[model samples]
Target: MEIEIFTLCDHAQDFNGKLVIVGTFDSISSSVYPFTHAACSLAGRLRFSEKESGVHEFKIKLIDEEGIELYPAIEGNIDVSKSVANYSTINFAINLGNLEFKKPGKYAIELYIDNEWQKGLPINVIKQ
Candidate 1:
């Protein structure tokens, strides 16, 4: 399996196997110690080879710089069916709301597939 695209964005959707992403960003700026981002999305596309067909466990975590989870881990299973082509792709969009940042610092959005770490997306909360 391969990750074709992964990002944090203002909005995202999977429209008939197509990924529509908007306002991709890596940082947030606020003047207060604790800030709440009203809404956002974590979007990605995963490609699976014919040999990888079957059910795969997936998990997403949002952790602070100190390795503390900001929210409960998102877990699910993805069923990949064999296609006529060399690979089959799956698009996903996880809508997040009321993301609270406790301080100005770095955070990580980590992706795990089949109990293996796949990617880490960094985000910074900046104090203005």
Candidate 2:
């Protein structure tokens, strides 16, 4: 399996196998210690080869610089079917609401597939 696209965005959706993403960002600015983002989305597209077809477990986690979890991990299973092409692509968009940042610092959005770490997306919360 391969990650074709992974990002944090203001909005995202999977429209009939197409990924529509808007306002992709990696940083947030705030003037307070604890700031809440009202809404956002974690979007991605994963490609699976014929040999990798089947049920796959996936997890998404948000962790602060100190390695503390900011929220509960999102977990789910994806079923990949064998396609006539060399690979099949899966698009996903996870909507998040009221995401709180306790402090200004760096954070990571991590993705795991089949219990193996796949990618880490860095985000910075800066005090204004």
Candidate 3:
């Protein structure tokens, strides 16, 4: 089971710039996806910094070709502080093998930040 983790940096920081955001994940299984990459626009990417103040919201959903899969189970909001000026770490406990998939294939899971709509990265699950 893999729970893909993403980051929400400041909207004024450079791509290579370092920043921090309070990250949290609620998972269906104890297994979790690894922290992947950050999703943002070219402008958003270059402007994101850890030294910003505000409460950013993030959401996750599991879906498939038929449509939405897992319902909203976990929801939380983290406050991003520019004072930290460094990357903070968080983790989600998930059990991937327990998920009831409509079919054995790739599943669509999404992650959201700051009440903005975002797509979930692809995750492969093999039924044993």
Candidate 4:
């Protein structure tokens, strides 16, 4: 399997086989200690192995600069049924529910597939 595109955006939607995304960014500023990302979306395209048709696990995590987890890991099972297509679309609305930054620094959004680390999206935070 391979990833074609991955992004963190202000808005994303699947409109009749189309992926629509807006306001893709990596940095945010906050005036409070616990910074809450009120709304955001993660969207990407993935190519899967055609050898089998079954269920696979997809997980995501948010980690702070200190290596501390900002929130609990999010995971779900992806159903790859009998299909002839090799590519699939994925979209997730990530709402961390008022996550505490602890301190201002760089953070990361990690993606995992089948328990294996796939990719990471770097995030920076600044205090206002």
What are the models' TM-scores? Answer: 0.98, 0.98, 0.47, 0.82
**Ranking of candidates on lDDT, top first:** 1, 2, 4, 3
Go through the candidates in order and give each one's C-alpha lDDT: 0.96, 0.95, 0.42, 0.76
For model 1 the local lDDT of residue 82 reads: 88
Give the per-residue lDDT digits (tens) of candidate 1, residues 51-109: 99999999999999988999999999999998999899999999999999989999999
* Lowest lDDT block of 10, candidate 1: 64-73
Off by over 4 Å in 2: none
| Lowest lDDT block of 10, candidate 2 | 64-73
Clashing residue pairs in candidate 2 are none
Off by over 4 Å in 4: 86-99
Please give, for residues 4-35, the per-residue lDDT of candidate 4 as tens digits: 76788877777775778788899888888776
Which digits, one per residue and each the tens of the lDDT, describe model 2 over residues 1-128?
A: 88999999999999998899999999999998789999999999999999999999999999999878889999999999999998899999999999999889999999999999999999999999
Q: In model 4, where is the ten-residue run with the lowest total lDDT?
A: 88-97
For model 2 the TM-score comes to: 0.98
The local lDDT score (0 to 100) that residue 62 gets in candidate 4 is 88
